[model samples]
Target chain A: MSNISLSAIFAETAEPCLATPEMNRATIFFLIVTVVGLSCGVLAFIFGHHTIYNNTREMPWGMLISTYAFWAITSTGLCMYAAMSHVFGGTRMGMISNRMVWMSIICIMGAFATIGVEIASPHRMLLYNIISPNPLSNIWWMGTLYGLAVGCMIIEFAGIVTGLGKLALVMGVFGALAEVLANSCLGGVFATLPARPYWYGAQLPIYFLTSAFLSGAAAAVLFNYLAYRIRNEKMSTTVHLAVKSAGKAMTLVLILYSVATFWRLVSFYVGGPELGRTAADALITGPLALNFWVLEVGIGLIIPIVLIILSRLENMSMLAFAGFLILVGQFVARYDLVVAGQNVPQNLGWDNLPTHFSYVPSFFEFGVIAGSIGVVAFGFLMGERVFGKTFTQKEHH
Target chain B: MNIEDLEKEKNEGIGSLPLQERREFLKMGLALTGVFLGGSILSMTSISHASNQKNADMDIPSEGQYPYPKHYGMIMRQNRCVGCELCVEACKQSNHVPNDHGAWRTAIQEKITRENSTEKREFRPVLCNQCNRPPCVRVCPTKATYKDPETGIVVMDYKKCIGCKTCMAACPYNARYFNEEKYAIDKCNFCIDTRLAEGKKETACAAACPARVRIFGDLKDKSTEIYRLLHTPDSKIWVLRPDTGALPNVFYMNA
Candidate 1:
């Protein structure tokens, strides 16, 4: 026992080695990328605030909202997976809990930044909501819950970094609950709208939660792989277990979500010529058909699911590819959700209604979304660099 | 008329004077006077009551009753509309709505042919219905757009608008427009600022119309030409999208 204790002490003493020059070089490269991203974001905001984006009377909710939903949902997914691993304790993803907590925090921040710009008067919404609470409003609940979840995750990440496992666990549980509620509420924002019948349903919240999990698992595997490649370090045994566990979770969710999506489309066809049917038509036969089939379903789901299965969840490269595919699919999914819901004319059988209404995101909108991503990547890279010691599993001699 | 003397003579003639006769005579005279006075008073009161009811029913011009001039609403007659673009032109001129791309009002020319080889082509001017239950009002996040309670006209306050275009979605009539340059929502205010405020009888389009297809008036007043025309057997009143339950005030003939 004394020999083991002495060896543990020796291991602890030896593990605080300085980050190598290569790690330094990678960090600097990420920093430069982040700066350039931020600079582009600033320029886009300045030039695009008043012009280029043509969100007219015909098209009210534009590309920004879709992009915002994409980021927000992805963050929720990441946070949920991280919390599940930490709280349950028996999960194969136990070792990478520290890194995931950081990723979740950074991703949520990115979500917030994108949404902040998307809303015309976010400050007004915040201030007015506080002064005169509208509990019935889905948006109010969504914004507030997401805000709380993000705050909790940040605290949990800090606690984990400081080696306070118990506090991190408690905060992690809180964060998971908050994220679950917020993600559902985000779906509820659309579901409660009786005006847009396509969005009105009980299925959305569940669909959103499933997507969140799927996206989260994909993100974890992708980011973990990227981190390993950057450091030129082999993933530890524990991280390998985590990747396998996440792959299984991803596969399961992909199947469930695909089923849900299929039924959702089917119901729209069975239903009659209200806005819901029209919205469904917008997906199946209208301008959005290509995106719906190719990006969201073909690339996002089937391809990734096939790749993950064919690889038997063993190969890191296949897992990473699947994760990338899922992310792209998730993006397309959100785009479809936003644009398709609004594409159907409100006045059915109206003579004066526009024959077809369409929208495509301008360069500025793309820049802002890109900038938001840059912010997340920068935050993650910096957090890892400064606090690399805390993220690693403590060596047990 | 010596009633007392006559009574004495009668008493002399008769064995005994009838005690109830004098009382009967007095009662009869009092009853006669009461009946005469009551009948006159009742007739007078009835005449006055009828006159008052007539005044209430009549569409007399009262100050401050309506926010706009006497004829505030626009009416489109089905027969007279020739599918001409005059009203559309007049609306653009009056509102200064961007003629380059978007127009505030338009004329719809629909041609329907029956199986019997009878063709009926209808020309209708479509603009804001100026709905009594405006959906646009319910959806405005900033409360920048509102319906006038007195006039029943949906109006947009461009300065306060955030250019969200929520109003556009809410408006089933497709009346609202977003100014791309100003980033504000715009639509027909029914020429309220110009024609209605000035106490004019007709809008620019109504005046410019050579066929007199459109009629403008207060719907509440029966005496107004539009109201009378709507109620008359010969007049056919129709409202757009009666199924929408909007209770639109803008009445159209053959719509």
Candidate 2:
């Protein structure tokens, strides 16, 4: 409450905090789009849930759940990345950890918002999750830990702004741990099911963690490039190294995750259960062939790896482009994973059984996606304004 | 309610209202009553009209510990099913399931293979297996759905369910449905709450099947029909989707 403490909220650095008119226009545009999408999300609550959403008894989880997983997983990646850089300190990743911390908080907020609409009673989840804890449920852990990560990140970011590096570092470590555990639990939510054979596995916890690394590394490069470009400043050597460093990690994880994906398919065909193989077949040569072969496998993994290699990790624009493609592929990949897992009916021999339950996300679903994107964009712009100077300064080992 | 009275009312306006006003009044009244009666009718239809249980009413009250000395189960003679689907109808009425939801608590799937002559068409009545190790119970975050300690039935606490439908995905039988009316996940609990809670020994579906295809009784009771059926080594018995490892209480004969 003191004058010095209040004033200390703003970093006392000589660097100017300024945005061009074009930047102002861009912010306004983002704000408009966000508001429009938010209104659509609100409309689902206002009119009725069943009215807007195309989800049925057959396919309970629709695109909204997929979008939630997409954002939540991305947020986990960001937080983990931040924790690694700052906790170790004296690394290029550490220098950019502040930005990553801020975005991680924002991205999780987007994830929460999407799932907020998806769950029928989110308020009860908040209250009862504490009062009536179920250690057995993976979903319970996912929700509770994500909530913990978000809280810790907020305090850690505040500590960073206040020049309390030690406090921030400690909180960053806990926040990172929570995010990683929560990320694995998120995977366990699907992977723990014995009934859903496609999702049932011991490897998913590790697989999902690998995905987080890939998404997080790519995000670090893309957002960092965008941040510098918006400032109309040349890339600093330290920041360039940070961006390229992310590129290298991304290349490695993309290859590993792709191998995991390959084995996941191959294992199904080789003496896997009948229904499980049928589900796998849908991904290989059936309805989801395009999403798997083109977007998830080719564009998401291979293309980005190719681009990073061809650019020799030098071109910022190319790295960012690859990052963008990686993100697009992740989005589609999450959708296909969720949809494909449940597409095959439990009874294969039953008469009139649908090969796959059709789920084409309506515009309301798109609104939720747009709204989630808006959340990240708004938070990113705000972070630039608040911590612009801090992000520009370089920290060394 | 009275068709002849409605005809007379349409011909002559009631009280001081005009002909058009009277018609609107009737429409509004009918809509209100329809909404009000729709749910009650669904719940009460089978309870009121079905053939009554021969056993005297058992006025059993609650205890702190487990109440029932048995775990109830069903054995369906699959070949005996004539594909009448009356069991499906009885289940819907007993559970108060909505017709337009495109979901059912129980259903009959016909398996017609041309290779077999007499056994060409066979109806398989599939319901919630009430697994000993229920995936629905395990995956529920709030313990919203759980196993009944007394009956060993996988029952749902309607109050606790968040309608996440995680249980639906976890159930390999495809037995769970989200009730838009109750705003909860609906599944077969062997009509434990509806029939058994009210002193009936068997589910409405088991009772309603005229061909006696379904034999329902306590698995723990040696004298019960279901117990005898399972104890017999001569008859071949199987559960649906054994690969799921649900360990279902519902067994199918003639598989």
Alpha-carbon local distance difference test for all models: 0.70, 0.80
Residue pairs that clash (backbone atoms under 3 angstroms), model 1: none
Please state the error at residue B53 of candidate 2 in Å.
35
Worst 10 residues of 1 chain B by lDDT: B55-64
> For all the predictions, what are the DockQ values?
0.08, 0.36
Give me candidate 2's interface root-mean-square deviation. 1.6
Docking tier of model 1: it is: incorrect
The local distance difference test score of model 2 is 0.80
lDDT of 2 by residue, A154-270 (tens): 988777766677778888889999999999999999999877778888987888888888888888888999988888877888889888887888888888888888898888889
Docking class of 2: acceptable
Candidate 1 C-alpha error for residue A209, in Å: 2.9
Could you tell me the lDDT of residue B130 within candidate 1? Answer: 73
List where candidate 2 sits over 4 angstroms from the true fold.
A1-8, A11-18, A395-397, B1-68, B116-119
Q: Candidate 1: what is its chain A TM-score?
A: 0.89
What is the C-alpha lDDT profile of model 1 across A168-260, one tens digit per residue? 788888988888898898888776555566776788888888889888888888887877776677888888878888888889988998999
